[model samples]
Structure formats: structure tokens, C-alpha cells
Target: MNKKIEKCAILMVSTDLTQKQIAEELNVSVQTIINWKKKDEFIEFKDDYQRKYLNNLAAKAIRTMDKLLTSDSDQVRYNAAKDILDRTGYKPTEKQNINMSGSLANPYEALTTEQLLKLAGDDDG
Candidate 1:
């Protein structure tokens, strides 16, 4: 592969720069970068770069979480445990169900002006 394309792939995964920024850094037009993205080889390289980059990031995060879990500070350990649980889909959240049947018109239209004002955090007086 060309050095420019290799550099572009590296810049893409290793930094948060936009295509325009990368183009500017590489002294190429944004369209040229867009064209590179459409090419099969460039697409494959970018996909590989992104996959490896994300894997490395996940590994680092896991290592950090492990360290935090073993921390002497109760708050740190608790936070780490909560984060792990949240990421693993073990955290509990309130579920709300709304009845949207044809028989049920907009609830807002049924409310009294005072009730609407109260709901809006304005005094009803």
C-alpha cells in the first residue's frame, strides 16, 4: 500500500480528527479522502485498524476496572462495581409504559390550564 494511504489509516483510528482535518494534515482534498474511503483496500485497512484500536481500548478499560475493583477506597470500589454492572446490562432502570390507543387522545389536551401550569413548574395562581 502507499505510504499516504497507510498514514491516513493510522491517523483515522489513532485520533479523533475528522476527514477534513485529516485531509488538511495530509495536504489532500476532502474529496480525495472520501474517495479513499470508497476504495476496497482502504476500506479493509480502515476496518482492520478500527477493530484493533477498539480491542486495545477495551483491554485497557478492563485492566483499569480490575484495578479499581481492588482499590482500598470504598467509594472507588463501589463506583467500579457499579460501572461494571451497568456496562454488563445488570443495572436496574425504571420502565414506563404509555397507552397510545386510538381511544386515548393527547393527554395534554385534557389537562386544565391550572394543571398544565403546575406540570410546567409555573404557579397556578
Candidate 2:
């Protein structure tokens, strides 16, 4: 909420300036920026500013991607096409890796409640 911290957050997200550079610009020590970076206020402000900045650029980015589709390089065109397809929900199907750590087969499939509890070392009945 303070002007200094708000300005710091804007600079952090909207520019490629390093923390040292931001500290220099703000007339603060690098350690000050480093300290501020760990604060919730700084993190929230930077994230909010970044979201707003990207949202504002979305249309321009789309236009650039569309233009790139006709680029002279085949790879560039293919990449642009692929990006557009991905954004439009035409992404390739991904193979999911199922991790079954318990057993190769259903370890307790043949067990009754009493037997399963016994296997689990919960035979308190």
C-alpha cells in the first residue's frame, strides 16, 4: 500500500531490472529489496501486476502469433501453428504414468474386512 513498495512491485514485474538495479532506482540498498522480496505484500503485488500486464498484452500476443504463422522459416511457422493449436485446445494427448506402489496385483482383493485389518496390523477386535 505504501508508494515505495507499490512502485517496487511494478518495476519488479514490468521490467527486466535486477533487484540491485531496482534498489538503485529506488535509492535503497540491495538488502532492502531482498528483504522486501520476502514479504507477502511484495509477492502479491508483483503477481497482481504481472497478471494485469500479461492480460493487457494478450491480444497483441495473439496477433503476433497469427503473424508468425506466415513466417519465412518453416520452423517458425510450425511453432506458431503449434502454439495456436495448443491454446485452442488441440494439444496432443499425453500418456499418463500410473504409479502403483502398493502391489503388482490387488494385494487385498481376496481379503475380507477382518483379514485386511489383520494385514494392516490393526487386529484390535
Candidate 3:
């Protein structure tokens, strides 16, 4: 609760160091780090695994967007949607259920998150 403790907690989160790493550096137990999180005062940093996953999702989204911009094919459209889903870490939200009579290449139509996820080569199973 001291200013020094608060500063340390902020520094730990900003540096991408996990709770264990910060604890080791500060000569404290991991439980202390967890306690900070539970109290909503601060939390652990982004571990390598989380960073890698975010990077992968960003790359996938970029590639898919490029494909959509270059090609007007139905497949390309599907790919764009898929990329968005992959980057977002959630299913796409559809506002309507009716299918319109436009080329599937169009991105402004209604498509299920499942369709986009499939196109992006992601596995939900």
C-alpha cells in the first residue's frame, strides 16, 4: 500500500514480467502478486505465451485483410471475416438473419461467426 509498492506493481505490469518473475525480483511470494490482482490494485504482466498469441492473431488478421482487398471472390470475402474473428478472440455478431442477393464477395452482408472462423482456418472444436 506504500508508494514504493505501488510503483513496483506498476513497473512489473508494464514490463511484461509475470507474477512469478516479479515476485522473484522483489523477494516476495507469488501469492502476494496474486493478492494484488484480487484486490484490483494491480495484476501480473503479459507472459510470452500471451504475447505470442496476440502477435499470431494480428498477423493472421493482416494477411486476411490483404486478401480481401486484392480479390473480390467469395473465398476472399470469407477470409476477411475469418481474419476479424481470429484477431478479436470472439465470434462475429450478426445483426440479421436474412441472406441478401449480392455477391458473396461483398463484406457488408450477414454471415455467421462460424463461417468466418472456418474461412480464417481457425478451429473452434
Q: Estimate each model's TM-score.
A: 0.57, 0.67, 0.31
Prediction 3 global C-alpha lDDT = 0.63
Segments of candidate 2 deviating more than 4 angstroms: 92-125
Clashing pairs for model 1 are none
Candidate 3 structure quality by residue, lDDT tens digits, 8-119: 5555645788777777877778887676656533433334434655676877867768768567688877777777777678776755544366424456346687777777
Clashing pairs for predicted structure model 2, backbone only: none
- In order of TM-score, best first, we have 2, 1, 3
lDDT-wise, the better of 2 and 3 is 2
Q: Against the true structure, what is every candidate's RMSD?
A: 11.4, 7.5, 15.2
Candidate 1's residue-wise lDDT over 66-123, tens digit each? 9999999999999999999999999777554456663534659878889899999999
Model 2, range 28-50, lDDT digits (tens) per residue?
A: 99888888889998899889999
Model 3, TM vs. native: 0.31
Off by over 4 Å in 3: 41-125
Whole-structure CA lDDT of model 1: 0.88
What lDDT would each prediction earn against the true structure?
Answer: 0.88, 0.87, 0.63
- Choose the strongest candidate by lDDT: 1
